[model samples]
Target: MRTPLAAVGLVALGVCLMANPLFLPVAVGEPDPAYTHTVQPVGADAVAGLDSPAAEARNGSDLDAVVAYDDLDPAARAAFDRARDAPEGGFGVEDPDERVDSLAYPTDPRLGDGLLIVERDGERYELWTRTVERESDVVLVQRVLVQPIAFLAGFLAVVAGAAVALRGRLGGE
Candidate 1:
């Protein structure tokens, strides 16, 4: 009976640990600047191509000329064309040695020259700036979750101690 009760306690503890959000790793990445813009050339071209009414008319379809850059509100569509056309690594430093070969975990954004940027959708998005500081509590929570077996062992020790104490009291009675 005591063995089954202890097993249940162990299982409950495992569930509790898994449910804790603090055990999860913080997703590290660059933070985007407020004025930054991401313009995917492929998507932009596709939108442009579709806006051509002549092409649609020639094809005998309900075609509309792709919206011109001028058509876009100046305030909403920031000047991203120049940034998009420029060569990669224009925003920040690139780590040539850092190869993204593994998919097991996400690569941490590299920091350089007070900025960290990641290229996505043919646009650079800032993930972080200046220094990347890790939260201390994140380290403590991860340390505990990393060694789940140790937690189980500690729990078993407590159960064993309790059983021994109970047995002693009963024997004395």
Candidate 2:
């Protein structure tokens, strides 16, 4: 009874996941706003171009530049590759080493993209950001969805497969 119920629940959950998947948070290639907004000398001028990106990059923050995802271990490198090969909207991949292991797919844009498991060496602490540098008006946004509709078909297959296996093992319902 429990097994059957669990299988049914999985199907329902998969359906919900298809319609309204989670909206993940992401950062892009840009300097920190606080640092960018800081008042600093521009070239030789104290106030000229002070509110520019050059000032932000010179704000003395190590994180001033976007993460170098390609320069990581083989495991991380694989994730970055899958992201690069992903479709226009991006795709997801299962990385056991990632923070969640399953939602480890990195979504990359046409220009460039990178991902870093900033915490615990896993993709869970995802700092989803783009590698391309665009104007402030441009925004790169992508979400992770692992074959939303296909999950439903897979769930059905599991349920049928389980029922058959259980029937053969138990000889009856």
Candidate 3:
């Protein structure tokens, strides 16, 4: 009976983990000084083509084939075109996410940059993006989520310790 209960609990725990959001690839790439755009569950049909290969690749190979940056709306297209020939922005001395920003670059001359990602959780997918536009004022999103696995593991440890103590005291051979 105890073995079956443990097995059922294990299966239940696995299911819970599978449903978690932290298990997904939720990356909080560096903020772009000139970029300020956020899209969740990105619509591939509209923005995919406008995205550069670098953006597509960062999101994953599947998006590399799917994003058609050419399919973007005219205004968005113009924004990209403007950035193509724009001057490159100054690099800050203490930027930690500069490497990630390098992977996502601007297509126009206006000196903006961006990144797109397809975060996967089980059979479901979430699209996330970061765009840097050169402007005086900018608002950044805190794109981080907590991991439930660690909390669950800690809870299980406490439960297991109690169970062992109970068995030793209550069940005598």
Candidate 4:
């Protein structure tokens, strides 16, 4: 009886762990809301202006702009590479004057028709009129499902083994 109870307790603990795994809190740096909200463009043409040569000289280019990690695809990757190689974080926008030192990917991203937001080093940059080369729903779903099932299965197996051991020990008369 005690052995069975112990097994049940172990199983319950395992279930709880599966339900809510331990996670560390992420430290988000201070966001430059002024730049994220005010300076960024709100339309398609404004986005294109950033990509032109004249714009690039000013640290402006749609390609050099920041984007969310999730929204990134092949084209985005190529753009990122081009931007990374650019003189000043790709936008051609200079630091201090524009107050933007290096363009980077956002910690969180929201995407819409011809628009996306990139959060980097606690500031958000907006990009417009761009294209994505690929999308991966399957990969995203797989990432979501795998963790819980794996934990639950491992927990159940351990509980079953403990219960069997207890039964054998008690049965010895």
Estimate the TM-score for candidate 2: 0.24
Cα deviation of 155, candidate 2, in Å: 39
Better of 2 and 3 by lDDT: 3
By TM-score: ranked, best first: 1, 4, 2, 3
Model 2 / residue 68 / CA error / Å: 4.2
Q: What residue pairs are clashing in model 2?
A: 93-105, 98-123, 99-123, 99-124
Candidate 2: segments with Cα more than 4 A from true spot: 1-70, 93-173
Show model 4 residue runs off by greater than 4 Å: 22-98, 101-157, 160-162, 165-173
- Evaluated with TM-score, which candidate comes out highest? 1
Q: Residues 105-141, candidate 2, lDDT per residue (tens digit)?
A: 2334111123333323332223343322232322323
- What lDDT does each candidate get? 0.39, 0.39, 0.40, 0.46
lDDT per residue for candidate 3 within 19-100, as digits (tens), equals 5455443444543343322333334443443345654666654444333445555544333333332353122212434323
Q: State which candidate, 2 or 4, has the greater lDDT.
A: 4
lDDT value for model 2: 0.39
Model 1 scores a C-alpha lDDT of 0.39
Q: What is the number of backbone collisions in each predicted candidate, taken in the order shown? A: 13, 4, 25, 7
Tell me how candidate 3 scores on lDDT: 0.40
Top of the candidates by lDDT: 4
lDDT by residue for model 1 over 63-143, one digit each (tens)?
232234444344323333434554651222233222112101123322222222333444333322222233465455556
Estimate, for each residue in 103-131, the C-alpha lDDT of model 4 and write its tens digit: 33333433443345554455454553221
Indicate the residue-level lDDT of 163 in model 1: 66
